[model samples]
Structure formats: structure tokens, C-alpha cells
Target: MLKFLPGILLLQVITVVLVLIAPTELSGWGWLRLVIPVGIVGVLTAAWFSSMAAHHNKDEISRLQECHAKEREALRVNAERAKHRVIKQAHQETIQEVRRTSTQANIKVGMAFAGAAGIGGLLLLTQFITLGLLMLTTAGGALGGYVLRIRQEKAKMELLPKTKTKPRLINASPTTK
Candidate 1:
């Protein structure tokens, strides 16, 4: 904005000097003709300044709109992320609850089996049979845990929505009408 002021002032000063340095023959109405050049220069100078100002204004507006659009997009993404986080947390909580319940049930069943094995070993009075029964009970408990894990995974899969494929259209026709 400040760079053009010196040039504008210099042009005005040159016009004034030319107007003053004319002979009387060339000075009368001919001197007045100098005003034409001055007017032309003035008009051109005004147009240059006006165009610069208008361009500056347009650039500023474009920058402002760009900033606003970026902010809006950021806000929208943040909102979507927060919503997804909440849903994920809920799903995690449900999984945790299922794990807890399954663990408790497994413990109860394992204890019952162990107690039954202990009573049967006492009736048979054999240490080898008691150890074998204990091993079998542990293996069964492990298998039950694995099955529970599979059930939990199946439940989680069921909770998810199914994906649907969109149909694609293909046409071999040209657009000439």
C-alpha cells in the first residue's frame, strides 16, 4: 500500500513542472492541453490503486472463508471421534461384563468337579485315581474357558451391523444426442 505513493507524487510533480516550462506561443491553450496528459495519468493511477485495493479485499475474504471452513471441518471430525469413542467404551464394558460372568461360572463348575473327584477318590482309596481325576478336571476347565471365549467372540460379531454391497451400473452408450 505504501510503495505506490512516491510514484504517484512524482508523476504529479513532473506534470506541474512541464506546465510551468512552456513558451507563450505554446503556453496559452496549448498549455491547457497538458491537462489532458495529467488527467490521463491521474485516471490510470486511480484505476491502478482501485484495482489493487479490490484485489486485496478479495484475497482477504478468501483467506477468511478458508479459515472458517477448516475450523468447521475440525469441529465436525472431533464430534464424530467423540461419538465413536463413546460407542467403543460401551462395547468394551459389555465384553468385560461377559468375561466376569463367565469366569465366575467357570470357577463354580471347577470347584464342584474337584469336590466330586475328592469324594470318589476317598471311596476308592487310590492316590493315582485322585490325581488323574484332578488332571481331567483342570483340562475340562480349560476347555470350558476356550468355549466361553468363542461364545464371547460370536456375541461381539453379532452386535456389529452387517455390510451391504452397493450395485454398480455400467452402460456402453455414448452421450451424443
Candidate 2:
């Protein structure tokens, strides 16, 4: 809109100069007739071009806005996917740690049972029947407790949220107790 200010000013200046310099015979109405029609045409032409420019700008703005919206949506999806991947990795790490600790526990328990059996056999051979039975009973109790603990851990793992889209695990870390 402001771009045509200089042209409009120039036209007004030219009309004033023509009206001032025209011969006295034609001074009154001659310049008025020429200037009025020319001014009208100039104004109409400026308006038409300004309207076209405004329409083009409107379309460009719409296109840019749509492009930005699509980009925003893509960024949101990527962020969600990244969040899921991080959660899944955490879960995998927790499971692997549990397996490693459980393996070690199993080895220790097996050793305990084996030691108990060997000592119980020696005690029995030495005619210590009562002591041998007690030792075996304690080992049995230890085995039972280990089995129960494993069952509890499996149950805990199964308690994780079922939704694959947004899985959540509470108490995912192994408890010492």
C-alpha cells in the first residue's frame, strides 16, 4: 500500500504544475478534465495490483503454515518413538541384570545343597543319624525358599503394563530384600 505513495505524489505535483502553467483561455476547466480522469485511472490501477499482491501473499502464508504443521507432527512422532525406545532399553537392561544375579544365586544354592548332602552322608556313615537328618532338612528348606523367591520375581515381572505403545514397569529394579 505504501509503495505507491511516491507515484501518487508525483502525479499530484504534475497536475498542479499543468494547472498553473496552462494558457489563461484553458486554465479553469481544461486541466481539471485531464487530471481527474488520469487520477481515477491511476487509483484504479494501483488498487487492482495491490489486491493481486494481497491474494498471492495470503496463499503463500497458508502454504507455509501447512508445511510448519506437518513438520511439527513429524517431530512429535519421532519424540514419542524415541521415548518408547528408551523405556524398552531400560527394561532389557533390568531383565539382564536379574538373570545375571539369579544365575549367581542358583550356583551358590547348588553348592550349598551339594555340601550339605556330602556332609550328611559322612555323618550317617559315622552313625550320627539325627544330625544327618537335620542337615538334610535345613538344605531342603533353603531350596524351598529359593524356589518361592524365583516364583515371586517371575510374578513381579509379569505385573508390567501390557500396552506395547506405552509400557510402564513399576519396581523394575531388583530388590535386595
Candidate 3:
């Protein structure tokens, strides 16, 4: 209101001067007086409303910005959680695969031992002592060879360094005859 005081006073003075200078026949002091006050009030009201609107718009923009920030944070957190979940699931799958492979290996070893024992028992029951001893010796030798081979292979695996590179094919494309 104070900022507009000088301009309002100047406007009032101009209107009064115009009314006084006008010809008697054209002049209408009554109309001018009423219009002048209404115009000033209208201008002041417009200024006040516009200022209020600007303040409200600023508040609304800040609120929207805050909401957007919170949404972005939530999205970031969710993404991290999803990544962790995928890693955890993959780890669990790897553990399960290892367990399954170990169980299969154990079953195969048990079957081999059981087969050797059954054959040896059958030979002994038929009164073939020499044949039974030979069979048991052969089975033991074979088992020992298998264990040695497995140990050698395990040692080889341990000696080799782990690599992430893909193996190159010896013959990637077929040659034309």
C-alpha cells in the first residue's frame, strides 16, 4: 500500500485537474468523483490478490518438489533392495546346486562299493575261495585307482588359476573340403 501511495496521489491529482479544466458542458464532477475512488480501490484489490496468488503458488511448488524428492529416494531404496534380493537368490541357487552334486556323487560311490561286496560274497558262497579273493583284490585295485585318479584331478583343479575369460574354440568354423 505504501509503495502505491505516490502513484495513487498522482492519479488523484491528475483526475481533479482534468475535471477542473474540462468545459462546463462536458464536465461531470459527480461521475469523476465516484469513478476515481472505485478505480483506486480496484487497483489496490488487484495488487493484494495477485500477491496472495504468488505466495500460494510458491508454497504449492515447494510441496511438489518435496514430494518428488521423497519419491526419488523411495525408488533408489527399492532398486537397492531388488538388487540385494537377486544376489541373495542367486547365492541360494548356487548352494543348492553344490549340495545336489555332492549327494549324487555320494550315491554313485555307495553303489560301486555295494556292487563289489555283493560279487565277492556270491563267489565265496559258491566255495570258490581263490576266485573270491581275486575278485576282491581286483575290486580294491580298481577302487584305489579311481581314488588316486580323483585325487590327481582334484590337485590339477587346485593348481590351475580361476579365469573369467571365455575359452577359444580350436575350430570355430568348418573348413570347406
Candidate 4:
């Protein structure tokens, strides 16, 4: 009704002008005489229906807006969940990498110890050095291997990206509403 006000006013103005200009022109009841009344009624009815349709359309538009808002909120929630999942996965990967690195370090240390023991045994059997020298060399080799293993482990750890020990705050709440 409100939207059709302008159209109604325009129609009224045109009707008044036509009536004033042709007072006796539309007085006859021939087929041509029916045209003016029919046309005027058709225009008015079309304007009324168009206004009603516009109201219905506005209602539908509001409903669609609400649906769109809900969909946007759902997408936001899903995005947040995905972000948290990625952080968790990264943390797990970091833990696995650290464990793998530690295991390799232990294996290297074991191999170094075994090789040093084999060398000391060979030296003792061949009498390459006195018993005291053999003991000193074995002790020195064992100590050196232990220190080298520690250094290697430190280097390997340093090569890896450090993982955050504490859980991170991914999203902070807004101070203003």
C-alpha cells in the first residue's frame, strides 16, 4: 500500500488531466468508451497487487537474510574447529619428531660404545699396549664417545623447530561487544 502511493498519485493526476481535457470525449458508450474505465481499473488493480507483492518479497528477503547469517556463523565455528585441529596435529608431530630424534641418539650411542669395546679387546689381545695403557685408552674412548653422543644429541635437537610446551590461546574474546 505504501509503495503504491506514488503510482496511485500519478494515475490520479493523469485521470484528472484526461477528464479536464476531454469532458465530452469519453461520454459515449461505444467500445471505445469502455476502454477508459477498463484501463483505469486495470492500472489501479495492477498497482495494488504490485504493492502487495513487494511486501511479500520484503518478508522473504528478511528470511533469506536470517538464513545467510546462520550459515555464516556455522562457517565461522567450523573454521575455528579446523584451526584448533591443525594446532593439535602440529603438536603431535612435534612430539613424534622429538621421540624419533631421541631414539636415533640412543642407537648411535650404543653403536659407539660397542665399537670402542671391540677396539679395546683387539688392543688387549694383540698386546699393542700395556694393560694400564689399554685401560686408560678404553676409559678415554668411552668418555669421549659419551661426550660426543651428548653433543650430537644437542645438535640434532637444535636442528628441529622448538615446540611450544604450553597450550596457545588461538582466539581471544573481544573486549567490546
Q: How do the residues 1-177 of candidate 2 rate in per-residue lDDT, one tens digit apiece? A: 575566668767776776676656757677677677667766876786677779879999999999998888777767777888988899889989989998998999889888997898888889999999888888888788888998998898799777666633332467697
TM match of model 1 to true structure: 0.45
Report, for all candidates in order, the number of backbone clashes. 0, 0, 0, 0
With a 3 Å backbone cut-off (N, CA, C), the pairs that clash in candidate 3 are none
Against the true structure, whose lDDT is highest? 2
Stretches off by above 4 angstroms in model 3 are 1-29, 116-177
**Total clashes in model 4, counting residue pairs 3 or more apart in sequence or in different chains:** 0
| Residue lDDT tens for model 3, 57-152 | 899999999999888877766776677677778977997997699679868986897698679879999998888888888888878887788789
Q: Which window of ten consecutive residues has the lowest lDDT sum in model 3? A: 163-172
Q: Taking the tens digit of each residue's C-alpha lDDT, what string does model 4 give over 1-177?
A: 576677667777766665556546454465455567658766776877787888889999999999998888777777777787888899789989988987897798778766766777777778866764676577677778787888997798799987654433345465796
- The C-alpha lDDT values of all candidates are 0.73, 0.79, 0.74, 0.73
Model 2 scores worst on lDDT over the 10 consecutive residues at 163-172
- Span of ten consecutive residues with least summed lDDT in model 4: 163-172
lDDT of 1 by residue, 91-141 (tens): 789989988997898788777766765665664565667666666676567
Against the hidden reference, what TM-scores do the models get? Answer: 0.45, 0.63, 0.49, 0.53
Model 3: lDDT of residue 172: 41
Please give the ranking of all candidate structures by TM-score, highest first, separated by commas: 2, 4, 3, 1
